[model samples]
Target chain A: MKRLMNRRPNRASKIFLGLLPFIIILLVYASASSQRLAENADDKLLPSFSSMADAINRMAFQEDKRTGQYLFWTDTWSSLKRLLTAVFFAAVIALSLGILLGVIPYLHANFSPLITVISLIPPMAILPILFIVFGLGELSKVVLIGIGITPFITRDLLARVLEIPQEQLIKAQTLGANTWLVITRIVFPQVCPRLIDALRLSLGAAWLFLIASEAIAADGGLGYRIFLVRRYLAMDVIIPYVVWVTFLAFMTDYLLRKFSKFAFPWYYQASNKA
Target chain B: MSILLEIKNVWKQYGDAVVLEQLSKCVSAGEFVTIVGASGCGKTTFLNMLLGTESYSKGKILLDGKPLPSEPSQDRGVVFQRYSAFPHLTVLRNTMLGAELSASPFLGIVFNRRKFSAIREKAEKMLESVGLSHALNSYPHELSGGMQQRLSIAQALMKQPRMLLLDEPFGALDPGTRSDMHKLILALWKETGITIFMVTHDIEEGFYLGTRLWVFDKVRFDPHNAEAYGAQITYDIDVDQSAKRRLKKELELELEKSEQAFGASE
Candidate 1:
């Protein structure tokens, strides 16, 4: 039975990657809240920004310069923090679930209509229900982020999954391998190109969602800072934030592309173009 | 030799289109049997039934004594015509997949490096035997068609299966490569006393590889296909030919006589 059971649990970078959000969240929080380490700002961190919009507003302003919109580089770094968190989380979830569903046809079929409906709903449409259900928490925003980004990510993953050469599966089975081995040993590895593509896709959507999210919510975050400056029409601050988001997203994409190239050197010659 | 593998009264159909009818064959241990038939004559269907891929409407296939499952495991390894090895994994991994797939699933996760390091070493040695050692880290796309088939053979053999099932493993290769692979398979058979069940359309290939060959010349009396394989066609030839073509004529006559001796259509 054990032979039948026990797929490799998450290990290596996959485990590090799976927990990355929590780590990065803490890192960003510590760094951003460091200058505001006064007991007052520290206490407010948990209570503030119940949702994506609330978080953005926190970055915008609230009479305190420590946590509020600042002159130049500070605002840039604050906005970069918000963008990176959203992008990294969005990219990971989308690529993971999207590729999973995309590669497994039965999963794709079972969730196909629901995924379509999920996509049709505006990316930000779920926040109201999110607020009611989760009651002003990060769950709503995170789930929303996952859903919003997954559609495009899933589409890309499905394309990549389909791109896997059928011959490989046939060959594995011919060699006396059961079904699961084919997925782990063959389909999964072969789908790296699509996984990379899906990561890039979700990353782009995450940035867009982050902006929209910060637009409506309550507290501190890069999006909130942008809206803060929006009242003052501070295009200068917005310019830096926009420039940094673009740069960060580009960096995420460039880094992932490089990683995929190095990790799966065989993808360079894949007959199936994803 | 206890009929190492047996196909009994096999009939197959894809939907309403019938592909095989009452086909039966018995292969002995340490024997190489090749099936030859015209296009759509159920040659592959017979092979599929033996390997337990396609179902037989009314037949039972036995390996040793137990019934063959829906998917045959370890008992048979097939080499497909296309480049079927996973390109993402190296040739070593591909060959090792046979052994890897059969081991405890946890073994794949725990002690992975240890498991793979050993399997990989064994696979590299198998590749060396097949003349594909240089492709140890190379992907299937990196190797030539002949090399891929050899890798496929190595993969099949890694499991140490009792029989190797080849579905035109070399059909996609060039003429030279095809013969080369045939020689490799033959040599491997001589080295290991395993049975080989191969399918081929190349007439010369069948003669070269098979100990006992069956040819479907559309000459059999098929009660189901009266209008199609209908009455057999008989050809008239001058047995006494001019001296100009004597040698080739004798060879052709000998071939025809053997075909008749093996129950060819009148």
Candidate 2:
């Protein structure tokens, strides 16, 4: 406690220091926006704070005349639902496949080379193919996110599973665990935290795929709204939408980190020592 | 002193390179047998075969006058030098793993909640026996080196196995901690009457801890034919050194190079 108190800056001050850069960016943007609006009241390049607020209020508070629904909440719900569905299925598939490949050499030899080949292919390069194969719909978008991130997540988790020491496996066997028992009881628990870690890393790519597919073709989503507003030079709506997406991604990553720490406290403490 | 394990001229070879040749030993129930050997002298390999993780090229190992299972079983428990306790589990959970595995090998302890308290109670008793009752919820990494080893030993003993295997169990501990562990092992042995087969690189530790000690080394090695030789029991001694002539004869047999016990290779 003494050492913590004796530090140059306290924890609260440190947090404030961390927020300084964000404050500076906001100030610079506000100045640039005000100056542009003063120069030309019709300037759409840098929308004023009032105009951005007006746009958000229209999208969030007022229902659209044509659709009879709030665009902001509808877009957020759709995008989040699609993203979560894709990530959930990808995590499930990757967890099982990674555990099997890591434990059984025969399965690893048969499938790992194929997984490696697939992982090397750029996910963006196959976007057109996904649309072509699955067509321009929800299926294609979700599949795009799954295909974009599944192999990488699987590979990450497979490496983690393989990193489990030989001694632990042998010990489990000595305790009368069969092959299935070892995989489920011994290997599965240890791999769960790694799965969350892999999912957290692949979230960025998952969001990128979601936005790209939505931009290409979507009726309603944050990405679609951004692209739709681009024609009218509605910088207010576009910038807010972008910021919202970033906030959602940040929240997801934070939640996953917190969940892993909560569920597997031992993992965090053990890894901290390492 | 009933025979608990019998090895009949066991020979282990990998392809054409021999690792152990014509090795045999009889271990009785409730006896502490310490094996001291140089590095690369097949000590770990022999232990692996005993644990049923590795296959022998020829001969057989019988436990309780029956052929031992080809794979590891609940009858024999092992404590490795490192990674003895699962870092992801608490001390109590690690100790309960054996009973949990045996009870429900399909689902594991997580879904076996009906018997969890029983297992936890047993594990707590074992931890108390090993002087780690206060660390029940502590992860393996949170404990000191000596404490970790003690937790591991407690984990192995919780199963009540007929035989226990220790592979360089105290090689990484400091002298002070090692001495404490030595007392713990002796006490546990006296209380449980479980046969212990330990392999160590410390000659003094082997002599001090065992009722019987065996030194493994290459009896014949040709420099030109590097793969021609294999390890065998070079010296076997009963810890009872009352016979002065035999004690001196055994003491003169490469005991001066005890310091090289950890360094000398095949």
Candidate 3:
């Protein structure tokens, strides 16, 4: 049989490659837990997979006595809503302002310095300020995420917009496109996929802000649940919650990548050239 | 034929550096004019001035005996060396852009069923004429150099401008592709009878395509104050008498003699 020089691995092998790391981590944890349990039959730090699985099942499927709602599902929903809302607002604002700054010289000259200054300020430093101004409710948490990630998104998108070739702009003008027309037909389409990419890069910061806010004051969120479990030395709940948050973040990033690829195949095609 | 474009005693300067001085030329209706010059000879500067994108320091450009506007207009369509077609649009959409833009409102082009079909039909016809019917769905980057140039020409002509400006439009193509482009351009010129003003460094291309060829170079340069001088029209030949085959040698001799006489070896 003839074999290609750079053949791709089969799907089964690829899946196994992806799962290899998690399997290693689980085996290591299980071995450590067994060693600890053999010495002292009451070790909480390294609970076995069965105990962790049981804890997740009860949290996800069983109703809580106090709230009469599945805490895990409720926490996931609340955290997702805040993160998505903040991310949505940040994307819209950044795309609009970034493109405006990039296209119009006058606006750029006037506003770029201010945006740069604001971007330089660390977002975490303002978490307390956000809570004070917006109150310790959902508004504060969402706004914290927005403030935390908007600057990064705006700067990234601004660079992308600026990177568009001067020839394209002049060509658009020669095609009888006015300022507004150029923005809509040329700049708008090119910047959209870049905005999605910028959003994906900023998602990590978004999650960080969401978790920090929830850990500080929220009653129902993934971060809040993790911190609450920490006080009781409930390592099982803490570890499972952390894993679930990671899984959710990974899914969001994956879906966004797929969406951008499907939405702007031309952009991807040009970029992926050899 | 009446004069369609007249440039009278035009002078251009950039800060203290003079680029063009007392440049006077005119193109009659339906005439094809090709401009050739060495680098830094203000050929592109003159072309931009004609397009009305760059403001001349001192002069008036009259189109149809009326002063041309100071900004780009649909009356003049320009095709650059490359990057002419919008990268994001497919070949068909690139051609359709002009018609759709003129038909649609200022804010945006409303894509109605009837207008869209009509515009599509017109664009398809133009694409077919330019020999890009098979690449209707291909993006600009997907096409070869020759195909991209053809698509850009189609895109420019779709607007039905009175004058087409070509700035080294085929400079980047290989020799074979360049000759094919020459044929395409001549056919389009003869068919439409639209006026053309092309700037090129290729001396042969300028002579082959132009009915009236203009040679531009810096006639007056000071070694100490070089920036004070600017290029002028050194030769304006009516190529109707020079047969296409013989023109190359004849012009080569002419250019060599002029270079020796003026000590402008470049």
Candidate 4:
């Protein structure tokens, strides 16, 4: 018989182990909700699973009395639009700036310190300033998300570009590559997969900035809906919304990971060895 | 024979520390010149100077009686012991990269199907010559050390460079693979008649592969400060095939003694 320290779980046991905690949490929540409901039927803090289901149906399936809009779907659509647009803009800006700073010695010398300083500043501290300048509309929310993640992603990508082997660059130059050709053929291709990785890592921060801006000022969004229902103690709706947001974030990260593997198989292979 | 490259009293220094001092040599076209030296003898630095990646502190390196460019150009191709091949590119793409860069200087890609195929065909032939034809689509990381070195050679040869610089290219390989690489390099050298400058730690490899062998050693020594003096080409011997076997034993003993003396000086 193997000692406990030496013992390792098989594939099936590993899967079971992973799910055990989630199952326990769910069971505890269900028991607490039942007990609270038994003590006081009017309890709103820990709503029953059935009531949460009912809230989802109302928000998603049923039309809102005032706007005649399916509140849940509208909130999801608007939030996704802002998030995707901001992310796209951030990615383009970060990639361009990162590559420029990484490749050109003068630009790197001048801008790297500035970028580092910007990254050090807490993005949320400038939330009020962003809202005032860009207004309380969609622009402000998008800008907040863009500003929040751009510096981090840019720094990450810049480091990746710098990490490229010097010999490879010399090799490229020897192969008849000029500066432009070296960047495009060698540096750009190598930095792309790393850009994807940087974006994936920054997604959590992006979402935080998005939700904070939306909660502070927005016509309709997942964060807006969740915060608005707090007055009525609508835990049923809030809980479901939070779970949905988590699922969306997870799905985005999953898709990005899959896409990176598909598009840059070589990068993944090299990283796996390292 | 025409002199392809000439070094006229070249010196390389970083800050106050000298790496190579007053190095002078003239290399003819199609000659295989192998360099052997102790570690930190500035052999790699000298190679980098010829490749135009490193600037000389003084004097000049002339190619075809003209001052060599301060930056690397297509006329010279280089292969390091590692990181010579791009990890992200497949074997075929790596080979095709040189031609592609020349074809589309700005973009470094060939968008036209016919042009792309032509480059691809050329790359395939180069890979076949290097014996890496079967692993065309495999990335560099997937390759064994010898195979990666083969790929590096194929990639370098793709440009049809007039001069090839190899910096300890087979240092990482096993003995069997190193011997195999030796055959491949000699065959390529004979067929293409490209002037070769190879740096090796193994003195035997230098004698075996080169038409001429150079030994780099520092003459002046400062016991208190190691950086006070830099290495110079101390010995240059012409190695004809007939005389190589006879010269090997004597040269090996002499170099060993000198190497021991160099260590003692330090």
**lDDT top scorer:** 4
The estimated TM-scores of all candidates read: 0.74, 0.93, 0.93, 0.97
**DockQ top scorer:** 4
Model 3: runs farther than 4 Å from truth? A1-18, B241-266
Q: Report the C-alpha displacement of residue A69, candidate 2, in angstroms.
A: 0.9
- How many clashing residue pairs appear in each of the predictions shown? 16, 0, 0, 0
Give the TM-score (0 to 1) of chain B in model 3: 0.92
lDDT of 2 by residue, B1-266 (tens): 79999999999998878889988888899999888776777888998898988999999899999998888888898999999788788888889888887888567765656688888889899999999998888899999999999988898898788899999999999999999999999999999999999999877788788988887877786766656767888777787756334554555456445325425432
Model 2 lDDT tens row, A1-274? 5686676877999999999999999999999989988899899998988889999999999999999999999999999989999999999999999999999989999999999999998888888998899999899999999999999999999999999998989888877788898887789999998899889889999999999989999998989899999999999999889999999999999999999999999898888822
Collision pairs in model 3? none
Alpha carbon lDDT of residue A197, candidate 2?
Answer: 88
Residue A118 displacement (Å), model 3: 0.9
> Residue by residue across A96-187, what tens digits does model 1's lDDT show?
56556755678878977786776788867677777688665445555666667767766666677666666555567766556566666666
DockQ of each candidate relative to the true complex: 0.37, 0.73, 0.60, 0.88
Q: Which scores higher on TM-score, 2 or 4?
A: 4
Put down candidate 4 lDDT per residue, A1-274, tens digits, no spaces: 9999999999999999999999999999999999999999999999999999999999999999999999999999999999999999999999999998988889999999999999988888999999889999999999889999999999999999899889998999999988899889998989888888888889999989988988889889999999999989999999999999999999999998899899999988888822
For candidate 2, what is the lDDT?
Answer: 0.88
